[model samples]
Target: MEQDIANFMLRAAKFEFFLVNRDTSLVHTKVVGVFTAIIGVNWTKVAQFVEVAFPFNTFDFTNSGFEIFAQTAPQYLVIKHDGRLGWDCDNEPIDSWDRLLTRSYAQLRNNVAHGNKHQMPAPFTHDRTAQFLPAGLALMNFIANQVFLESDWDTPIFS
Candidate 1:
């Protein structure tokens, strides 16, 4: 289910890019308004859903998990760590999947919201359509593999 949501988000991002690239007239204030709303509201909602599934709550605030998961990780970890610093120090190295997804999704959202609607970037040449497509697809695959594939809801919640 999480994978499906990520896929849908990727497709939506791609479609928005395609539409803006094909029709300059379509790039009006209204479109930018909608883009801002999507990034600010929709993306955050998706991120929260991802958090519920994966629950990166084993790392400290200084770790990548806290940075990516925000307050949730520290709050959850505190229950087991009991104010001890050794909790994160002793655990096996966890992959920084949440950080990667958070950063990439934020960038994709910014590009959609702020990239010049009237002018295409040099990377996105007049004829080339593949340049910006990878970010969307990569994010989708990352979310699918990291959050959905690895999550075990049957495991006990920390808090």
Candidate 2:
């Protein structure tokens, strides 16, 4: 039942089974907008539940792309030293791949939504954005599952 609901949310989000037939530059650029909207509307709430302050300002991505955001954004999600997925509070010095991907997504969102809106930097090029699409979908799925499992339903979330 939970899995069904998660699938429903993913479908409702318009990213249940995304595929790129042509993988054009236009598709890549447009996907940044889609990701930004979903994250702003859905995933940001999930992050807030975990006490994470998501970066929504263009200045966060203006100076540098992924590198700057990775350094500045809150490292809430990470792989612990024990190889378990947890928060980055222990100062283990190991970078979480999930965190990195999330940072990249945020940077890409800023680049397209606020910047040139046509071409991005090295790591967030059109091809890389195309490649990150699946990972972005997976991240959204993870956020949805976390919300469903963790929320007690005491208060209604508006956004």
Candidate 3:
């Protein structure tokens, strides 16, 4: 389990390198958003393609933007919804993880993939970057530490 999480974090770190090296501005934002959703799919049972099935302690993943774990899959996701904030999955009409993803990373990913790159955070700002990039990276970093105490993830070198 520890090794699996470390491997996942290594991949996530590679993505970070790509983001820092190849992407900038809205492109960077787009990359970050996509990366964020990827992280979501891996962390939660949201998507199955890159699904990471390690022994994750639900207790370690509660709150902090994640829905409280219900057995395995999360019961809900914490994100801004409607004209206000907080939208419960049961009360809303969400057919996919789009509505429940953290910071609407799925939405940004979908929007970019579909060529509707309008209203994006315009890069150079956390609006798009904050949309997920840092949070996802931080989450993965945290999870990595939780999984591997001796991991030197803090001193990442893109090489």
Candidate 4:
């Protein structure tokens, strides 16, 4: 039983890593798409569309404006909702990890899309480039653990 549990944990860790990488890649692609849309066209016009889509006030181009937009981007909405629901239900909040990962990715996307050349913060800073992999892995582990625990493995593992 002990060996089986150990093996399961090891496999879970590997699977979690894989899931995180995949999720991060997907999020990164979405962020890039949003960034591209913003850059490929007039930012003022794009900002208007973003405002309407998100139903928020216009984002100022100032540093504080970027900071606010970074924190409240729609990409992190599901994570935030999950975190709130988890708290309301008295469950452990795994969504916080997702939010963190999303924030890291969003910041990177924002900087690149906005043409900022400064270095990003630590945990995100890697070899002078932003590194979002760690946060992504953490979020993946949280989600995988939740799913594994809640799932009935006794049933067929696949369809």
Per-candidate TM-scores read 0.28, 0.30, 0.29, 0.21
lDDT of 4 by residue, 104-158 (tens): 4333343333322233223322232222223323333333344333232222334
Ranking by TM-score: 2, 3, 1, 4
Highest-TM-score candidate? 2
- Model 1 / residue 111 / CA error / Å: 1.7
Of models 2 and 4, which has the larger TM-score? 2
- Which scores greater on lDDT, model 3 or model 4? 3
Clashes of 4: 0
Q: What lDDT does each candidate get?
A: 0.39, 0.35, 0.35, 0.32
Candidate 3 lDDT over 72-142, as tens digits, reads 12123235545532213344432233233322434333323332213332233223322333345444444
- The parts of candidate 4 lying over 4 Å away from their true place are 1-101, 105-124, 128-131, 147-159
Least accurate 10 contiguous residues by lDDT in model 1:
70-79
Residue 20 alpha-carbon offset, candidate 4, angstroms:
14
**Candidate 1 ranges with C-alpha deviation above 4 Å:** 1-10, 14-41, 57-103, 116-135, 141-159
lDDT of 2 by residue, 1-159 (tens): 234334434443343112121112113222464462222323222334333333333223233323432343322344568885543333332144334434544443433333331332333232443433344444444433443342322223366
